[model samples]
Target: MAPFLKEFFPDVYKKQSEIKDSSNQYCKFNSATLTMFTSSLYLAALLASCVASYITKAWGRKISMLTGGITFCVGALLNGAALSVWMLIVGVDL
Candidate 1:
């Protein structure tokens, strides 16, 4: 996904390249920024799962499912309307 984003989004790819080149820690590796950014989704999902489990236990399954569905739709809208990589990241994180 990181590689695909870099290939398809020129603005994001360029910004990531600049950031990577400027950061000493990531300067040694190409696509390091994108790799980290993409990998964060897994972490976000893991954390969201824990929260969702609690929500389900407290609110009931139906409510929990509806909330999740609504959240997903909102996140999709945010991602679709993103104007920059940061916005896209925020949307995906949501």
Candidate 2:
């Protein structure tokens, strides 16, 4: 998924640059920023999985699955509505 997102970075950056003010840092992210974004997601997912395992053990598979589904839906909505690069990152992190 991270690799897929990276593949679209150029298009995403172009559109974001067009929509945002020229001075906005969000519109100026370079390849290093992309690497950081992907790395952050990888780290967050790793930590979340560790915590989710405990929640699943305590709550059972059904509850865990439902919680995950709801969380994913909320994240998708956030990502879809994001107006800035930071918001998009937050949404993806969610």
Candidate 3:
């Protein structure tokens, strides 16, 4: 079971190096900085997910879903408008 899980999620183990390469391709940064930036962005998204989940509970499932849909749209627009890493970060924050 353990081996099967590990094989199935090999990307999970290799994701950091892959991401570091991708980040370097997209932006001028060292691996360490890239890791921090990616981690920060992930943290932001996780927080957003938590907030959305809570709001969904308070506002009803439909309303929460609608809000999440809008957030997804905004995120796509941000990606399209991204000129730099900072823009990407700001877009995700939005």
Backbone Cα, N, C clashes tallied per candidate: 0, 0, 0
Query: Residue 17 error for model 2, in Å?
Result: 14
Candidate 1, superposed: residue stretches over 4 Å from native: 1-29
Summarize candidate 1's per-residue lDDT along 11-91 as a digit string, tens digits. Answer: 555666656355366444455556666776887798789989999999999999999889888889987887666766777
Candidate 3 lDDT over 5-77, as tens digits, reads 2443344445543555553554333345446546767887888888988998899989988888898799879
TM-score, candidate 2, is 0.64
**How many residue pairs clash in model 1?**
0
Tell me which residue pairs clash in candidate 3.
none
How far out, in Å, is residue 60 in model 1? 0.7
Q: Rank the candidates by TM-score, best first.
A: 1, 2, 3
Select the stronger candidate by TM-score from 1 and 2: 1
Query: For each candidate, what TM-score against the reference?
Result: 0.67, 0.64, 0.59
Candidate 3 Cα deviation (angstroms), residue 42: 1.6
Q: Which pairs of residues collide in candidate 2?
A: none
Ranking by lDDT: 1, 2, 3
Q: Compute the lDDT of residue 57 as modeled in candidate 3.
A: 80
List runs of model 2 lying over 4 Å from the truth: 1-30
List model 2 lDDT by residue over 1-94, tens digit each: 5443444466555555456466665535556657766776887698779878998999998998898888878878987886655666777777
